[model samples]
Target: MYAGCFLVLSLISFTIQTETAVYIQHRMGWNKAYCMLYFTHGSWSLLWPMQLLILRLQKWNVPWQPFWRRHVAILRSTAQMIQHRTLHLTPRQSQQSPLRYMIWTTAYVTCALTVAGGSWYVAVDMTTASDLTAIYNCSAFFAYVFSIPLLHEKVRFGKVLAVAVAIAGVLVVAYGGKAEESTPKHGGKSGGGAGGPDHDAKEPQNRALGNIVIGIGSVLYGFYEVLYKKVACPPDGCSPGRGMLFANTFGSMIGFFTLCVLWIPLPILHFTGLEKFELPTGDTAKMLLVSVLANATFSGSFLILISLTSPVLSSVAALLTIFIVALVDVMLPGDLATPLSGNAIAGGCLIIAAFIMLSVATYREMDEERRQKEMEVAESEVDEDEA
Candidate 1:
């Protein structure tokens, strides 16, 4: 139930973020990609604080000292679980602080995520819209590939088919009919929505180079997701509440890192005159805020979803937004008359079908894991009684 709810939230907020990002760049003429990325990601630092506030309000009658202590303890235990990658921990292990380790891990992981995201910003101007959309969404396939070794995920036929189908749908949507036309209306450059502003008809600055950059970004993006799942998430069987708390806390760490460490680049970019810093005014500021908040919501929810499930599932789930944003575009003021193409309908159906298929496979695997764990516990208890 929690998974379903967060999935929906992530998809909706992502759509909003993508639309606002496009508007900021295209309509407002503020093509400051790095600045937008920084703001959106930096907002993640608020996740934990916001979550803490909500939790406190829920337990409003509780005294501060006990409430704070209990909250800290839960986070601490979850952090330990993340560090050790196990549910059970020894007393000594529990006492040991994973804070320093988590900090170092967060630093490197954030670097990977920043670079992966930066690639999209850099490539958007250089590549064709269709190429950018198709290649970046390929991260879903990479996620599955990385899962085998990093996550010890078995090679399941059902999962393979689902992932393949999802990618096929993306291609159909991206390059199906008039690869140039349909793709821009649906999947955009950053794999979110919308191609570059409105000048996509122009020749790409360097299509070959852009594809290579985005290709690397696709692989790195997949790696980042799997790394987060392995290094930050508690092991299977963790309570949903605990998982949610930890996920937001980790998201805040990423946001806080962006705020502190990532600021160094802004001045450098400004000095280089590559992307001069400028404050957005009036409607741009308002829309930018909306975009940032939407991105924060989407990022936090995505982290929670990944924590609660496998990275493969979350990556594929994100693909649903491509179809959703397309539908949203159809309803917008100027494009209301532009109905979805036959290819769009066909591709959307394929993506949805793939999601359902993958969901069933994942849940079945989780259930089997739960039953196996229960059997192990029961057998251990019987052995102890006999002894």
Candidate 2:
């Protein structure tokens, strides 16, 4: 039953997020800065505290007073821990400072920039859903690469296999050969427009550029995830729940700050005629509303996933999105040319198979470790009795 619910929610979040990204970029014409501002500043992001609070009270039956108190204590503890050299900024034991705080906050800023910037590029440059998704999903590869050196985690055969297979799948989906041209879902014209063949000729170049941009964004975000483990988690002083609570609050505060600081750029850009800023309206407004709601749900679901499963598994679960997004693009049209290429299907299958292999390996290893620990404890007890 849990598995079923997990799948359903995962599918919903991935589908909505993919479509929202595509639609916003291809059709919305909203600037990246404005998009980030709207998302983070004095808006839904600021309300994360209240949103998380309500979730806590409703789902865990946690008392409001206790929850509030725990949040306060955790914030205090995390600060002291950081100040006292108890918790470093990263696995390298780098010291924390106001500068580091600003740097980490860039994770949030960069996150916004990547999503909005990448979407813009994809909308204007990329030709298919497979291309957009294939590039976006490369973050899993980035995560694995970063994890080994930065986190100093042990390398396992199964994990290596999983990563290899998943990456291979992405390559297949992307390069497996183009599908027959059909009506673009979001109405990107290739064969027509004022420029004619000269315009059409640029499509391949633009798409290659977009793919590169997306890949870079994927690398940054993969590091962001590792940073969360290495630097973002408060410390051993706070319980997992409490750590998460203040982390959410801390992020909201950062978002609020970003909202204010970001205003400096929009007017400059607008006046300079670099990128025009406009409030979303009409279909754009409606689309944003849906995206925000979907994002909120995704965030909440992600939080739940972390509690229920390891972050690594959670990431694998997200990898499934690339497959779903491409499939959706094929089955349902929001905007894009032919998405269901033969290569994409075969690639998606490989990715899914990789995820399953990883899951089995992870669980099996965990169980073995648990049993080993139990045996050691039992042996120690028997020795004590004989004495």
Best candidate (score: lDDT)? 1
RMSD of 2: 6.9
- Candidate 2 global TM-score: 0.70
Question: Worst ten-residue run, lDDT, model 1?
Answer: 185-194
TM-score of every prediction relative to native: 0.95, 0.70
Clashing pairs in 1: none
Compared with the true structure, what per-residue lDDT tens digits does model 1 show for residues 1-387? 999999999989888988887777777888786888788889999999999999999999999999999999999999998898888999989999999989998899899888888887778777877787788888889989999998999999999999999999998887776657432533322233334554357777698999999899989888899999988899877899999999999999999999999999899999999999998999999998888888889999999999989899999999898888878878889743346778877888999999999999998998888899899999999999999
lDDT of 2 by residue, 1-387 (tens): 343365458558546754664466545655353443346233425445675667686758777788768766555556445344365345333333344564555456445433533343333344344455455556666667777886665688888788778878876765566521321221110000000011222345566775566566667656655555455455443355555554455445545655656556668878988568777788877876665555545544543443334445555666666567667777664545334767768888998998898788867866887899899999999999999
For candidate 1, give the lDDT.
0.85
In order, the Cα lDDT scores of the candidates are 0.85, 0.55
- Error of model 2, residue 147, in angstroms: 1.1
